[model samples]
Target: MGKSQKQRAIRRHNPMRVPDTHLPKGLASASSSSSKNEAVLPIIQKMESPEVGERKWACVAVSNIIQNDPSTRRLLQGKNVVGALIARLTDSEEEVVVEAMGSLRNLCIDGGYDICAEMYNKNILTPLKAFVPKISTTLEQYLANPKAAPENAAKLVYEFADNVITTLWCLSETSNKALNAINALQLVPFLMSFLACRDRLPLAPVTAAAQCLYVLSDDNEPAIDEVRSNGEFITSLLAIARTVSDARTSHGKVDIRRLQLGVLASGVLKNISPLPLAVASDIDIDKELVTMLLPVLQNTSLRDATARVPVLLSEQANEVAVDKPSLKNTPKSDHRSPVEIELESIENQLRTTQLALEILTAACATLPDPDVSKHDEEADEQEDEGMEEEEIDEGVNDEMSVEGVPSKDEVKSSVDLLPSLVPVLIQLAEPTALSFPPLANPSIHPPTTSALGAVHIAALECLNNIFLSLARNPSSTVQADTVAAKGIWDGLWKSLGLVGTEFGLGQERRKQFWELAIGVLWGVSMVWKGFLAPDAQEVELLKLFCNSSEDERVRVKCIGTLECLAQCPTAVDGNKIIAEYLFTLLPTDTTPPAGVEPAIQAGSALIDIYSDETFPYDVNFRANGYLERLVAHVDAMKKLVKGIDRRKPGGRELRLRGEEVRDNLVAFLKYRKALKL
Candidate 1:
């Protein structure tokens, strides 16, 4: 084949789609021409050409068009186009494979089970098998430098995994590819397991992990069975955990050993008995791995690691296995850790333990209440009456309700047998220490460093999640019930007031830590809403939160929190300064940040708050023309919604939230004749 013809074949066979919003023509043409459509037409012509480069361009054009009009997606599934794309996967050209992945992603976006099954049957996944290893290697390199390409690569892999997950599991005839898919499952698992274990990892990984896990962990019996049947693969995971103790004894850094033990714990937790037994034989329930792992927590370095490990492990172990090893069993020379310990010590040694204690408490609290009211043999007459109307379909709640959580006796016995870390959490969130953020210019307070600032923020987040857990289900123990709420509310108030601070002595670190603190507080208010009362104390807290002097990120979260609280029946004022504050963040008659998706999303979510008809507000009250100000921001919202859809095409659209804003705005406008203009 001639060079031109090979290029043509490559383009024709590649399955990737082009994004639709690119101005059709190159910038030079766009600038010269009066009409954007005229400029775009030439680009379309080039894309549709059978020439090699032309076809590659055409694929991009097609993808772009697909974003605007959903109807053309069926064409990609046609034999003429799809067969061409599949052939390009093996074209020995990197760009061709990239384009092929893109095309396949577009076709598979939001496809039904039949569509996914058909795509799988057509051997579309074969290309992905060859493609992902290359992409993963490429992304691993690019992530080091931080570029657009590697992120795009990550997105493509995420889309493919999502499609396979949604469809019913079928082992592809291509054995090598099926194995590769199984191996690929490890990446998603690692990512999800990381997020599940700790929330401190950066946002990119968390977002990517959630999407990937959602796809891979969908309940498909066939996939579950197939993964489990690969003999001893599951057992080997448990057996490998024993190496952690070996590593620790060999004088390895306990942190690394604890992390490995943590991962192993999570792996077992995710795959329970039926799944494990299907893979491994002669597994002793009594000699389960938790006992071996529990000793690792003795080293104070392993506290946080230990905490997360058990949430996953507690789920794996039966009643006997979990209680056999105790925190008391740790060497007596190791003193009992107390809440009065210094804030820095808690940050370094015991924070993870605090989190683990919260998890254990939650697991204990969520367990089914033991069957207390038993059937009586003496109720012979009632038994006959019951037999007369027996309805066979008794379904149980999947989630344990607060009312049905294990009794005080059950929790006390289970937790008492293990290590005691509840005091560590209390110490971290206690009012006596007052771990506040450093001033805006830390040089002004030379004694405190940025590391201190970061530690302060992390402690706040830990306090928040702990508070959320407590509020979700208050401990029945009288002592616990008395102090948990007070300690949490006090810390929350202090953190809110310490809003303007710099962390790590640099602008980026300062901003990052600030954003984190805000997220932590927002998490507290929103996550614990179900268990907490919206009393006067809470209203005052909300007022302090929204009264921001600096840190726009802090203000943004405050807005979200207040929005949530406003919908609460006991909120003090429904239409308070929320609308005005939201309008300030939005782009005015002025242009907004050129292409910052995060900023746009923030604006959209805020707008949605004012517009939601479901939002609890008096019909008579109105923020100074909130709809009119919001209408001026419509262009910004539309741009953001489009950007999100474009960026995460096969992924969740931002419009799910944006649409709510638009609808509410329309409804509010219709009701208030004066505001319509």
Candidate 2:
């Protein structure tokens, strides 16, 4: 009796130990060597008990087991472990609830389908939903009286909000059930509210809410539709995207939280509207939202930082003072941190660039495709001519008017962001050095190579979209101004120079570079034809790129650019250079041209030149002898097409293209004859 009484007294004094009388059958047999599954059941049973001390002990035990032993996760799912944890969400004891949330979160980290599905079936989110109002109340209280609020108010609010959001984020990974639950609970607006209160709230919950929204809306149309339907939610998200904190460290660096918030806001925007115009259709976003994003797309801070050149004399002196022999033994320097930060800046900039591009792409989608519109207009005219006068009048009435379409002014306002965007592209397209300290071992902290092919590709696509938008809305005076700006043209020319120089760039990037270059040329010609003439260097680069074997798309684009240049009244010398180049591709009266594709492309370009009534026809005809060379090239194309066998690969298509060129040439000759030229 004395020994047993002494042992019981000792156990009663030990706060960390659960008395054997309190242990369930599962725990009573648990030992140090026992598997966690065998140990979790009894602890889970105590977690559901009414006694506060037992519940607290059980919660702590379960958290440790689940956090430390990965295998216990599936074992805990065997019974009503998740259901019990969910029920504990509103426990009067905050510590118990926190432990439960942590364990639940851990379970979800690798909690396979069966575990999550079981939790979903048990309606785990019901108790979680009850905490939302608590978060809202805390946020409202803080907003009303920030100075008077309890010290733990912000902490409590963030914990509750983050736990819920994280649990949902985890659950959403397994199925759409979590998302469905979120929608049913109307949690989207709450999450939006948290993000809106970001100025006062901690970033952890704000980011958690953002991430939850990102996951919930991604590829989930119903969620996206819901997000879109909420005007306030959309407004709040855009505000977050635009908000920039003024906080900076002693080093003068902006807080990383600001960058993260911007990125998350971008992710949310991408998930919700993805297509900017679709969003614009329902809301007046063209001005406000686009204005917010344009600055990000044009961010040249990374470029500015890397482009900073040290004074030449100082650099030379520093190089001379460095001891080369001791470099190998020198420890790695802290200078690499700035390079790392620069890379981070580049990453953030890329994210912003991508978001801006998505917005632009969406805006572009709302407008008509220029080529498709032209084809449609031609088809309509033919159909109208075939109808009787009364029928034609009726048809005109039935035809949709372009009046409701977004005006060129609106389109221009959006695409005019291109001028700001082009310099960023040129900056990113060129490589920059990431040098370590001279004394540091080069092998240890070797210069960081800036591989921005993805950035380059995105920039190219953004440029293409801008060009496309401009082409579709030729009446946009704003875009015309953007195009005619010296900055825009200078950026384009500099980018063209960077085409083949991006280190570690892949073939796709090269193709993208050419596509962007050619697209800019064509866009300029289409909108402000003959207004800007190519300089001799520009013309020569086009010729070189046009003749390149690097990519067929590049060559084709080069030819198109040359044609555009030739049509400019200010570029008669360019026209002559182009004419001579095309002449060289002609069959020398004996053999066909080496490359059938280039020949066809050259012939097509010449046809475009001859058909350009806007060009100074007398100068082309007299000074350049363009008419004579064009006729000769057309004759050579006819011979080349005839020489190719129709049965070979691409032979038939090549011949067809050649015949089309011949027809265009013949039409131009007839026009020339009619004018007695």
Candidate 3:
């Protein structure tokens, strides 16, 4: 990990990704060009109708039209559709109010952040306030006699309850001001009640309640306090997420819905991890959650790893989604069509796997307090100085903890789980096994066997953080570095375990681990032959990864690893294979996008490769097209550097690095000319 990527805010499955399974769909989705026709205007006008039926129909129509259509959502918002929907929320008919709440929830989902703020500005929460208490009453009555509440409400009470709760959850997530209003609902205990009734109630309503809790407890002080207060709620949610069911359907298939419910339940725990949710005063939530999640990662059936000839090189290779789950390709079926079921099941499996990795990632993410006084710089430096002195004076090392607490780099529970985590992360981090005869073209995304490339990417990210956390702690037994020269002389990477040790690598893992191990070698000051002469396996791994057409973003990670290797003088080597692969990533036919970060990474590496005294392919500089490529890459870097906006944050540093790289390349060229070799 570079300085830029050392710390990251834990990721959440975007709350706005509304699974509107019961929402209106299959109606003609209004197109973007319909904006000019004022198509939603008529619907908005009808939404204000005096007749309840007309208003109800219009609300459902709006929901149907805008569920997956951002263009129509914008068009609706422009026509004051939010205000009209808010009007429907207070309709005399409860049915109309429920449908309207559903529409507004879809708007919040489809319209993105702006529409959410607009709904808040319209005071949607004022009506939303009454539904919580009402649902609490309905839930109790319905649980007592499952059919009784629906008969009384005239519509299924659970659906009515779900819409209201989910709608409030969506709105609260998007707008900060909406939190206070939602917190006042005193909704934690009520939502927990719904979660407790999951076995009896429909999954949608149960999921809605869990989702409501997730949004509430995520970084919100008042809401987190509410969750900590309702101890059993958190306990039950984690238990559902943790339990892997063997319940078979009548068709003898796995009960996937129950499993997906686990995904939702786990997602709630993931969203608010590191916040203790244990009911028992003695139990530790972090350790308990880790124990529960380890088995989820251990299920080897989930990983359907694929091997293929590089897609750019093969005739049989089809284009896989670079980012799967694009909105445009989402199944259009309002009902559970075969296509929809297949896609949903695939996505659900991917989500389940990802949620497991993310929860582990988040649990391990012991990031420094973001708001904890940046102005105390002198204090931080003094502390660092003290930590170093303490390590040195003692000769051995300080315990990785202080007062039984882990450092900023690791979560206590995560450190305990690393022995298990390392093996799982390394295995999952492997890309679609690309059979590469190094293509000259820039890396293209290939057909990953079981899609969800995000799962692989997430695994890598979580692994990177773990590597950092373990390496930085002196007391950590996880080997992250070799000594400067003797460590290299004795056996290269032996200390770091990339070559040999507890976390030993196989043919595939060696490469994936090689890319990650760059951060481990970052500060080691060694000018040794081992750095220059990588073993055949290590070089082959680099060659495959740099040219691997798995995912472009994953390829960028390799480029970044290369860039880090190039930046350090001790780490840089005269490996011809590494240079050839680096050049293959840069474009020759086109001037690359000036603002693209990947282009910067490749260019920066190129400059470093040629700038130093040792050149990867110095003998074939002119014959092998290295000279021509160098000049072209330099020109491209110059253009990008000049075009960069130096006024922005890190902009000046980026531009300066580009200039330095270019200057060093020029000096190297001059030295080559003077030597006449």
lDDT of 2 by residue, 545-566 (tens): 6665455545666666666667
Taking all chains together, each candidate's TM-score versus the true structure is: 0.36, 0.52, 0.59
lDDT for predicted candidate 2 compared with the true structure: 0.57
Candidate number achieving the greatest TM-score relative to the actual structure:
3
By descending lDDT, how would the candidates be arranged? 2, 3, 1
Which one wins on lDDT? 2
Q: CA shift at 501, candidate 3, in angstroms?
A: 35
Q: Residues 291-398, candidate 3, lDDT per residue (tens digit)? A: 665665666333342222232224323534233322223212234434335444544555566666765665665544222233333333453445432233221112
Q: What is the C-alpha lDDT of each candidate?
A: 0.40, 0.57, 0.55
Q: Which residue segments of model 3 deviate by more than 4 Å?
A: 1-12, 16-39, 150-155, 245-254, 263-278, 281-284, 294-335, 367-457, 474-677
